[model samples]
Target chain A: MEEKCTNVCQNHLTAVGDALYVIGGKWKLRIIIALKDGHNRFNDLQRTITGISAKVLSTELKDLEMNGFVKRTVHTGTPVIVEYELTGYSDTLHEVLSALGNWGTMHREKIRAER
Target chain B: MEEKCTNVCQNHLTAVGDALYVIGGKWKLRIIIALKDGHNRFNDLQRTITGISAKVLSTELKDLEMNGFVKRTVHTGTPVIVEYELTGYSDTLHEVLSALGNWGTMHREKIRAER
Candidate 1:
């Protein structure tokens, strides 16, 4: 029983570690939320996310793309246009995002109450 | 409609930011999970977590305590004993942790498929 419990604990740790590796950084979740909100174009994302610089945004987008959460499309036109959209896999994070948002609000309230 | 949408987006950004701030580091979630799994002693946690140093574990526990996710109790006896446990507030993250674990498993499968 103890060994089984330890195995379960280790699995949970690995799962959490994996989740963090994909969505762990400061900007990943923010960027995912932005894309989910229909801010698809590079400039639109930059403007909507507030203080994110273009370079950091670019790097994060690439990371998201490589991880399969985001799809990037380039349109050739008078001026080349680039857009990013969340893949179906990214939609799997909706529940996680909602949970995080709720906890965050509660945490903020707790902090405010203590202060 | 646009103004309301923008307001909602900003609120989400803020909430997510707050969540990350509270549970954001490399070790915070791991520590929380460890404590949740009945590993309370400092040395036990250090062993269960596998690459965490005593210094990092100590810092993260302090942060978790400050954020209300963890409680620390000191027992004074022939030898002083310190133990950490998850607070009720930490239970609020059950859904979030489950979601993250599920997603992480899926992500690992996706990566394996690609490789």
Candidate 2:
């Protein structure tokens, strides 16, 4: 019985691990939320997401793009404008984000009550 | 206006940051899931959560306890057994874990489709 429980738990552990790997970094979800309102250029994202350094934002954006959560576009214009936007695939995370946000609010209240 | 947007985005960013801070480590969620199945002794948790080192498990358990998500109880017996259990507060995280697990399954499928 214990062995059977371990096997089932192992599958759950892997799923959680995969979720964290894709969206686990300090900046990924923040960047995603920043882009939620609308598409953003590099500087705009940096400003919108408070406290994110330019280099880290650049790297995180690239990772998001690679993971299919974000789309990066380059416009052929006099200034060659570049923009980043969330893909449809990224919309799949809305519930997860909301869940995290709701839990965070509750956790904050719990901490305050303890103090 | 962009200023208004920044203010709202800042609030969201803070919430996400708080959530990540509490449950962001590689092992924290795994440990939480392991405890979800049942109250477990230290050695049992060590086995249930694959790949976690004894030292890391010890530290994470302390953090979870401090954060009010876990309760530690010691049995006063000849052998002095210690057990860890998830608190009701930790049950609040069930939705978040489920969302993560669901998203993770989708993400793995997405990756496989891409390759």
- lDDT against the true structure, each candidate: 0.85, 0.84
Candidate 2 chain A weakest ten by summed lDDT: A1-10
Candidate 2 local lDDT, A1-115, one digit each (tens): 2443466577788888999888887889989998986638888888777788999999999999998889989999989989899999899998889888888888888788879
Per DockQ, the best of the predicted structures is 2
Clashing pairs in 2: none
Please tell me what DockQ candidate 2 reaches: 0.61
On the 0 to 100 scale, the lDDT of residue B56 in model 1 is 95
lDDT of 2 by residue, B1-115 (tens): 3443556666777888899889877889888888887737888788787788999999999999988889999999979989899988888888889998889888888788889
- What DockQ does each prediction reach against the true complex? 0.56, 0.61
Chain A in model 2: its TM-score? 0.90
Cα DockQ of the candidate 1 complex: 0.56
Q: What is the TM-score of chain B in candidate 1?
A: 0.90
lDDT of 2 at B49: 75
Per-prediction TM-score to the true structure, in the order listed = 0.90, 0.89
Q: What does candidate 1's lDDT look like per residue over A23-99, in tens digits?
A: 99788999998887888888788888878999999999999999778999999996898889999988888877988
